[model samples]
Target: MAKFKIDINANKHFTGELSPVFSVAEARKASQFHKGLQGYEPTPLRDLSSLAEMMGVKGILVKDESYRFGLNAFKMLGGVYAIARLLCEEFGWGIEQFDFDKLKNEVDEKMTFATTTDGNHGRGVAWAAEQLGQNAIVYMPKGAAEQRVKNIRSHGAECIVTDMNYDDTVRMVAEKAQQNDWKIVQDTAWEGYTDIPTWIMQGYSTMAVEAIEQIAEQGLPKPTHVVLQAGVGAMAAGVLGYLAEELGASDLKAIIVEPDQADCIYRSGSSEKGEMINVGGDMATIAVGLACGEPNPLSWDVLRNCSSHFVSVEDKVPALGMRVLGNPLAGDERIVSGESGAIGTGLLAAVHFSDNKAELMQSLNLNEDSVVLLLSTEGETDPVNYRDVVWQGKYSSI
Candidate 1:
């Protein structure tokens, strides 16, 4: 088994200030726009009380994203919101003037939206393009799950399976988008590509907005800590950025987790907490969505500024987490968390049940008085692999 690893970020840049892109204001703005979308309902925020009890925490809250816009994933929030914002800017239509139907009517010619994804983000881009009466072409990294590709194609978008790894595939799509005059709605930002990705990051903060509101509804205290799973750190930036802005950065602790093979964020933070470092090659892990080798430069800044610690774990760890959520303990709601979605939970479970619980607990500042929030970002995006892990016991903890 690959050993679990942790990195504490030195020289954090959080000074109770919010970046313009992933700020709380942007999240609320995105949330308002999202509310105007058809079939928009906030996904359930489930309290894993039994699991919290088992782990000796005061409260454990999980935002279940499987039901998001009926997409079985939360990525569409970023994808759709970014598209809407892009269109609004392109046509001088205000956000209030940018409802789906109204925007579809305003489109004179079909714009092609293009992006690369391991799975969820591509589907989101494709779905948004389809909804806007435009065209979409999604590119996937080598050996991406067929199910994820199929999901994107179902949105009437062209799906391209590349022979390259994720980061390289991203470059491929960038070239393709430029060649075809397509709008690249990539969630990760590189140089000269900050605005759209920034909007996408803001879109993700909708979950954080709802989670905080839901916590208040339940009369639970604000989350003392947040456990975020990173893939290019887009989702991590969105959620953490908003949280740090809402709750004082110094008040909330952030933990970032990733598959050991693709833990670019972890590696970047660990190396004297310097410039963003990247891992390359096929990150052959079951958590395919989290198999991104490059840290998004936009989110890398947010993560380095806000995150307290980074943890990297083996594939078996999230498989263990899938089992834990799949098989509910007592009255806790069974959340069919996919490999990428459940890694945070898996890491928690591994630490709680391990011989190093004391050390791990202290390192994470996880204690009986702490209220923790975890994001189950996607459901079974690839049902076959999910069944293999949860049913066939592939990558079992034993």
Candidate 2:
């Protein structure tokens, strides 16, 4: 079991901001990368009018990622892209050279790739490893739910359970990287090793770009507000980066949400520095993804400066949002979202903190027309917990 320590001093070194929004050239590159990715498609951007009415909102849009690459989550784009990019860089091989069959044939079962994840990210890395025929060693915090762990191992990755929380598992992976000749491809960046993580963030831009096109095709209002739930903030950073670059002066506000107990981004924004807060105990929910003690070193600066607001929501919000999306009112959509995945919709309901309800209705202008966008970033990564909360009304208390 790995021990997680709050490194007050280490957090200080992460005080720099994100790179500017993608340049036209960079945007084009990201788009091309998105296009090159195999079996990748934009998840639907659907309106959940019934839920919106229940929340006293004019309109609610859900960017459902449950269908992303048949992986049931958005993490696959980042982790798999990072691995593909790293492999290409090391071998001087074009990414196009990586046919699934060829990559699968190359594995000798001797080399291992290491990453630390709470849930979706690990499943993503494991899925990538299985596709590429590489062995993967995943380090996860001890309290990770069985369903999430099973998902990772089911992808043929070896899972290591640690005694600490998500932050410590990161350190555990770092140590493993040093002791073993394993390639470390992680979504969150640390000092000096920021490139691959940055690539992972860039890969996430594909989703945002897809969302823009999808919204346009649907003839809906442009997204006025984007609610992102952060762990280390990489996912939020990725989406925001693309939106800033492609969406063009759309009066978009990026609202960030985190667990009340694990509110590192909120505190970091308030503290005006990259901050670390030790979670009091085991995580209270199996959103399993957003329970982090600190924001990623590379992402905190970007999140603090670029995001419109950082709000902390109770864990129950996600469970409620998940139920709402799956409810009969939502129709046959089958939006199998998990806790963290529902945070965006949770923020939509808790509009006082968001301060966007008026803007949502376009009441300030009396247009009575506006659009709100929420990202359902994962599917039911923890089906047991999902069933317990949504069906049985019995959620595990932390």
RMSD of each: 1.8, 6.5
| Candidate that would win on lDDT | 1
lDDT per residue as tens, model 1, 14-91? 344557678888889988888888889999998989999988889889899999988999999999988988998988
Q: How far is candidate 2 from the true structure (C-alpha RMSD, Å)?
A: 6.5
Residue 307, candidate 2: how far off, in angstroms? Answer: 1.0
For each candidate, the alpha-carbon lDDT, in order, equals 0.87, 0.70
- The candidate maximizing TM-score is 1
